[model samples]
Target: MPTVDAVVRCPIAPTFRVSQLAGMFDLPPEPHTERRFQVELPGLDQPWQVGLIVGPSGSGKTTVAAAAYGRRLRKRLRWRRDRAVVDGFDRRLSTRAITQALVACGLGSPPAWCRPYHTLSTGEQFRADLARGLVSPGKLLVLDEFTSVVDRPAARLACHAVRRALDRQTFAKRLIAVTCHEDVARWLRPDWVLRMPEGTLTRRCLRRPRLRLEIFRCRHDVWPLFAPHHYLTGKLNHAARCYAGLVDGELATFAATLNHFRPDRLRISRLVTLPKFQGVGLGGAMLDGMGSLLSEAGAESITINAGHPAVIGHCNRSAKWEFRRLYKTGRKPSGMYLQHPHWKTSAGRAVATFRWKFS
Candidate 1:
């Protein structure tokens, strides 16, 4: 292992407001000081993928990243705050790759992708930044203030998703994350962690949290909370029976099952998972659980009209569901088209239908 060193010095003025306040409190009016960060990290000789520098605010995490990785780091991770979410990456990458990166990072909504970065929610923007970084990854990728703006659950989910994405890549790269949140340590599963505040470094043997999902019947009122995350924005069918999946008593996934026109059949009219939780397969798990429950209750089959490519691909790959057919729906010239003008294109959009039959 090779050693890396970083030193930051900020000269303090005795006449500054902070120094005056300290003097009033009988504390020493400290002078200029140098803060040092040194670590024995896996260099060109060793096999290592991820590195973490974590501590509270003003703890020199960003300084350490800057000192260690330098200009290459800044160039690779720079986010265009003024650009639309989908346009914030290398133009050389295929559209599929860009969309895939965005989906993997949990900002999979089509509408959100079209909007500018500033318009998105904090969580969405966080995911969009991750997606942009992953689009054209370098030998070293440095991220500052990782998950600082998002909630704890979102932070963990983003960490897990990012790790998964890195694992799937065929090339060799290193990810250095500077964050204050320690809760994501287990989810990130980095090769090493440097706790800046404690001045301690340790190799991580991480254990991921076991996600316990509970599915039960829910009322129509809960749909409003989840409707915004869905790709198709419209009013949910009121007559449908809704089911919500909860992880640790917080709503994670939702689906609406309704009686089909045929006998002994049901259709999933609406399915959605919260944006932060989307990439972790929670939506598919909820769909399977609901299908199992309906099967036990004497339903012959359950079907779904899935337009999202991710959902369609999952259903096709799953043993529990069989792909029925792929077809295109006629263009709607009503309020739906007025609200979502993107669907006005005459290009035939493909929709995949799937069915799960109880034996």
Candidate 2:
């Protein structure tokens, strides 16, 4: 649920066409960087405020989207561009609402009304992140590796959902999806298709992406511990209380407490995955799981201060979260990494913060 203004804008935009993209990718014919191809896009006559960039892995799909959006943010010699602005947002509100906002951004549908991101399937998080990109009005939505984790059926369903959402939009919104999957072309039914092979780009008319349905049930009483623990600990920013994924009624992994504290508008003070579940997905899951709940609580959005790309990816991808550029921390940051400064000695810390949200 970040403010629209906070989303990073690329520094420049390029007038990309199939030929230019193809040349840059070095498809079949090798061309010098300066020898740009006269671009040809038969389908694109009018200006495409929104666009889709399709390519395989290592084909620079993200690079293209990034470049396009950068240009969209820039003021040209003839075109007057307005500075992007966003409304006020807080990262501490309801998680569900945040999930909705993320979905609006193009991440995916929020988890169940109350379930946090930690409890969601990985594919669900992908959709949530897609939704997040879509929330901002008039911004182009770009998704790389658009549907890798999901089975074909689920991917199709997700594609259809997004297509429906975009097709029904009141304002102008663009979508860009990157994938090596040839089948995606058919399922997504995109207005434009840019195919990349061996680092070269080309155009193709293929089938759209497919839609699929999938479901999983909690094997135990897993939903009752999150907010309860937050309330008990008096740390409203606490992200989650459980670590182990449930297999039937037995705990398949270790248990731990995960929490985060936003000391300022720009940084998080405490982010701990605890000891037992240190290397597991607990910390990341908590952030993802709590996203929806935080949004529902009335926060405009959520933010995380993380350096580890893995953790960042968890929030940005596994949980469908976005990030601002890394803010430089002046002092040695404490809280989640080491000991939480808020801990008023051992007495308060001993209360295992391992609570659940399902109840």
Candidate 3:
């Protein structure tokens, strides 16, 4: 067994306004205080993967983690205001690795990756930070105030994504999350949990909550909420049926399915998972669910037109979907062009199109 001890102390000003206010409340006007963090491990047989320190504000979570790990603990990610999310990672890592890391952290949108870090939403920025942290070379990664800024659902999904990413790492690295939110404990499933204030430490056998997804028909007006996340520019098809996938009553994925020119064929034109909920298989699940629904409704087959490589790859691997063809610029494919004709690649060439048929 290994033991660790940490002690933190700081001086306070007795003559300050805070002290005067404390006097009015009949509280102690102490000039200094000390906090201790002591722990003993049961055995050195198994390697620790994740350590969590949770408590409310001013509970000394940061101080204890810093004292215990010191320079080995990476607390804050270095960020450039104008740099793209992909460019913020370590230069030594390959582009593929960086992209995988970003996607693993739930920032999977192509448009989101190209934008400057400062332009990202609060949730996107949080995931970007986690992505960078996950790829950086470090043995002890300490994330202070984990999920403190995002809403509860985003935080939970982020925790799940990060945990899965960490599990897939080929190297030996330990993660320590210092947070006030205990709701993520189930998703994080940390090997060790250190509770501040009470100073309680426990080894947990946590299981991830089964995500209950509810797919329901939604109106076309819901398109605006998910349109910004889509890589291509387009308006919703007038004849399309929009569907939303909700997890715990929160919107997680959206899709637009429209009937093809032939009465027996249906095509999925738009499929998008919200930024916070990406990389969780929600988009694929929604597509499959909607396809099954239409198939049972007498539709012979369903088709999907996708430009993203990730979506294309997923379709190529699924047994229910078959790759129809790939079309480049200046070429007309067999099926009708669901995407706008004006949508071209940066090089003025037609973007690579991947078509899949699902039954």
lDDT of 1 by residue, 1-359 (tens): 66667788888777778777987898766688778877655564567688888999877667766766776453224456777777877888777778888877777788788888888888888888777776565677778888888899888988887776677672245677888999889998898888875657788758766677899999999998898878876578666888999998999999988775554689887888888787766777888898898898788878887887668867976899988877686234555556766542223566777899566
Clashing residue pairs found in predicted model 1: none
Question: Where in model 2 is the C-alpha error above 4 Å?
Answer: 1-50, 70-113, 170-172, 198-359
Best by TM-score: 1
User: What CA RMSD would candidate 2 show?
Assistant: 17.4
- Candidate 3, run of 10 with poorest lDDT: 343-352
**Model 2, 5-112: lDDT tens per residue?**
112233323435746876888855333332111122323234443334555565555554444444433111121123111111233434444444443333321112
How big is the positional error of residue 82 in model 3, measured in Å on the Cα after superposition?
A: 2.2
* Rank order (by TM-score, best first): 1, 3, 2
- Which residue segments of model 3 deviate by more than 4 Å? 11-33, 41-45, 167-173, 309-319, 322-359
In model 3, the Cα lDDT at residue 109 comes to 90
TM-score, per-candidate, Cα-based: 0.82, 0.36, 0.81
lDDT of 2: 0.41
* Candidate with the greatest lDDT versus the true structure: 1
Q: Candidate 1: list runs displaced more than 4 Å.
A: 10-32, 74-83, 170-173, 197-199, 328-347, 357-359
What tens digits encode model 3's per-residue C-alpha lDDT throughout 219-260? 999989999888786577778889988998998888887776
